[model samples]
Target: MRMNYEENAKIFKAVSDQSRLKIIDILSCGERCACDILEYFDFTQPTLSHHMRVLSNCGLIEVRKEGLWNYYRLNINNCNKLTLFMMNLVTETKDCICNDKSKCTCK
Candidate 1:
């Protein structure tokens, strides 16, 4: 399903931070426990939790609780939606009325 602009914006915001981007990259490899994820970073547990919360809230990642641990993985469905949104944003264009005399570069 297509996501609304606000939802897409949230996803963009979630990835705006370097920490969160790195978190997503880690999750991209496969599902991993929160502790395992923490090992890959130098930040505190709370900081990692914050990043995970943002990613989960934005629908960019999914989380599962097993005992005292939270496992995370990239949400493929939402990722695909985000991909389509980006593709449309970059490729969808309006027709321009530029001619040779206008010096417009739209080809």
Candidate 2:
């Protein structure tokens, strides 16, 4: 599979934060309301909102509105893509970038 470096970089950046990683772990269990997620941290609601926005923007999580509440769940497709990306990144394959060394200037 071809990888889009820029898109994958954005995903890596979004989850770089400790708080965001925890949030993803929480959502991994199942869908949750914003309020329910907020209970997991000591930060203000706005902070949680910021983290949620980052996760949402990166396509890692999906959000839905139910009256005054916003529900969140992991985007399983994107999560699986990320897993595949990581696996491809580490494992050698015929398509590996290093295999195309024609661009190499070193003797």
On residues 34-77, what C-alpha lDDT tens digit does candidate 2 reach at each position? 99999999999999999999999999999999999999999999
- Put down candidate 1 lDDT per residue, 67-105, tens digits, no spaces: 998999999998988988887666634422232346866
User: What residue runs in model 2 are displaced by over 4 Å at the alpha carbon?
Assistant: none
Ten consecutive residues with minimal summed lDDT in candidate 2?
A: 97-106
Please list all clashing residue pairs in model 2, or write none if there are none.
none
User: Candidate 1: lDDT of 65?
Assistant: 95
Model 2 TM-score (2 dp)? 0.97
Error of 1 at 67 (Å): 0.7
lDDT (C-alpha, whole model) for all candidates: 0.84, 0.96
Query: How many residue pairs clash (N, CA or C atoms closer than 3 angstroms) in each of the candidate models, in the order given?
Result: 0, 0
